[model samples]
Target: MMSGRGTEAVADAVRRAFVNGMGEPVAVSTRRLSPAEADQLLPPGSEGLTVVVPEDDVLGALLPGITVTGAVVVADETGARLFFTSVPVGGQHELVAAGIRAATAELAAEVSRLRTEAAVVDALHSVGRQLTAQLDIDRIVQDATDAATKATGAAFGAFFYNLVDELGESYTLYTLSGVAREAFAGFPMPRNTDVFAPTFDGQGTVRSGDITADPRFGRNEPYHGMPAGHLPVRSYLAVSVVSPTSGDVLGGFFFGHPGTGRFTERHEYVAEGIAGYAAIALDNARLFDRERHLVGQLSRSMLPVVPEIPGLDIVTRYLPAATGSKIGGDWFDVIRLRSGGTAFVIGDVVGHGVTAATVMGQVRTAIRSYAQLELPPADLLREVSELAGALFDPSFVTCFYAVHEPDGHTLTYGNAGHLPAVLVRPDGAIEEIGEALSQPLGVGSKFAERQTVFEPGTDLLLYTDGLVESRTRDLTLGIRWLLSGLPALREAPDVGAACDELITGLTGGRHDDDIALIHVRHRAGT
Candidate 1:
């Protein structure tokens, strides 16, 4: 006699059997009930298998008997058995009964296998999603560690990134999970050994039930044991994150468990899939870094180094955006004009990266060429604007150009869709010059020139919009902040120190857009 739950369990087992064996859905019932009771409990068109009395009229001999309705009855010394299947057949009854029994046994094993495979697939998909969600290398490694540990049912997991220093020597950064930071604090990073070599070198996957038992485990000299507080590990599985395009190994995923044979072949496959996703993430990060490096180099090369001018102390600074922000097109130059004046220019090309940098280079060259003609500020602005429009077609630029005359004690400057240049007076009063601006260059916009008395013992400051523009603050507020902070900056010993202090005050030393600043202090005596 079986309880109600036991009967349902048997029914589920038989249904699985029917589907796996016959490729069809069939109802099965097992309970301790007579024919009349089973008919009452079972639904119409469903089959019921129940225990029955051998003395019942349907089976006089108390041996196994098959009914026309696909019900089979068998009598053993302990009790009578009944099996109900959907289809009724006219084959050898004993052979059919034997086949059904065999299928039920096979169903149990197949179901277990299917469940394991499904788990592996789900784990792979989960890790893939995590890996693709972001490109930060540290976060990617941490996520990989978590996913690998969970997928393999390991006690601990770690990811190691192979990195090269500026000196071209190789080192690694590690992200760990299922372990204490304190445990690793006192321990040295693991080196390449017989056990870790396969994955580290990209030779193949390594799955070991007991790493210490392997004969070649510690072939390297001085086989120091694991750290004292390190978690015990008997099972080990490692997979290498290898770039498919370059075939270079970027990193490795390593898992460990205290119990031997904790990881299986299925776990290895799941780890492999995780490694593939991580490899892609690493490749993307590398490409982004490479592009930023190249753009930084190009933009820096285009900026003119400050030249020593008589009676003028000039200082310049260029700050690129923080990581993850696009490289911008801000530039500054200090050129000795053919008229024996110092030309100070700051401009921002209206985009980012290689294209913006290229356009900026062209405009700077045009401005320098026009300045060499010793034209007045307004005429120079007009010529450079026209040149930028013709050369950089759709891209526009905002510029402020000024030339300081040493003998005349006057500053001649012009603006084209740019921020105002700030002049700090000797009395700590601030004035904004070049306020009358026109449209930016590359649009054939008109420009105007303005002259102001650049009094002795005063300072001049010119910068791109990046120094005064942010999402939360308008240009007006940024300018106000700069003006309010000028009194304190006027006492700085030199233009270089003043520029550094001004940047720190205005931008807090970090900017979303690139910043270019040119500062000049005029003295009464050279």
Candidate 2:
């Protein structure tokens, strides 16, 4: 009658009958099956209990084990019912018949009992389906525990788990059911002390008919807090909650009722399956949290604080891509020039994560190293282009470098496949330093790069593409927005302050892409 949910129903019925018989002599139950199902379970007198009416001629031919001692036949077309007192015979016939009758009835009842169980399983399935559809763990456990208690007729059902600290040596009590008692969630079960401890310890499984009856489960001094044999208690069962990777005993399951002989092996199997799923859910959540922490750590390590220069102001900020996974390729640097000036540089490597950020660091460090020995903006960028191509992928990076000098107007700068930085002037003028033409670094360009001296207090801004290039907008518009913001930035007290103002003005609230900005100011008179 139970179309699905496997053969648990029939097996459970046999177990229930045995438990019932312990209280009374002849507790009987029947499980019905289709002709096909009956063949699989009963299998034609395999248990030697198939009864059939034959012509009285064949009664004596059935072997003395099945012969009738006395009979009065009432015959019909379908069959015959004869009044007969089976003669006493040996070979444990009394015990065998009683066992067969109990087994057969239990199997017969299973067909119906399973039909009811099938309904409950179907309901549980529906709950699982709903919870899984939304991918919500708390809701899934909540619905599953409630549905299971109602379906199995348990006096109470609750969930228990362990919150392991990273050290792997300590754990706190954790649970997820709607139990009213504080002890339900506050009580910590030791990984080595529960009925499930042996299972977790040996990586095996365990079930108890009564907690007080089993040596492994009953005599545990640690379980004194549990009311297993107390006035309100009866039987209990538990399954090992374990780690999928380490097989560590995270915790155990607990189920009990006031009825004697309430827990059985089949119940143990069901609880184990539920606990296994809960373990997987808890594992997934833990992994998610760990990954987030790692990403944050890596991102911070990728951009240490900018090095301090004796007299020149050097400031750099790296904002990782907001919408992307927690890593990006934006980078910047300030190098003190041998000629008593400083090189303000900004560029972006074209990717994200450890790889992109790594390449960005190399490029940033390489620029500073080469800057210490060069002065002409165009020449320094050329050295960078050739060295980068030699050391990295030919198409790896886009960059811009600007060298600032004492003359308010004598600034030297060039671009190699980098966005021309936004220039904010002392008069509140905003303009992108126009690069007439230059190939992006690593792309090999022959068009000679150029440099120009400009006005005093010129704040140059640099950044990666994540700033202006949303899926809906053009990249050039982002550049132009930075260009427009320059007028306000120019009025800021210093280069460091202007960079902050420019970022807020351009990104609205947050920049989706990595944003690296550097500002350079000129002293009016030497």
Best by lDDT: 1
Each candidate structure's count of clashing pairs: 0, 13
TM value for model 2: 0.55
lDDT of 2 by residue, 441-487 (tens): 66754435556665555556666676667666688887777666666
Q: How far does residue 336 in candidate 2 sit from its true spot (Å)? A: 1.7
Cα lDDT of all candidates, in order? 0.74, 0.57
Model 2: lDDT to the true structure? 0.57
Per-model TM-score, in order, reads 0.73, 0.55
Model 2: runs farther than 4 Å from truth?
Answer: 1-175, 179-191, 196-223, 227-238, 249-305, 309-314, 319-328, 353-358, 409-411, 425-429, 434-437, 447-459, 468-515, 519-526
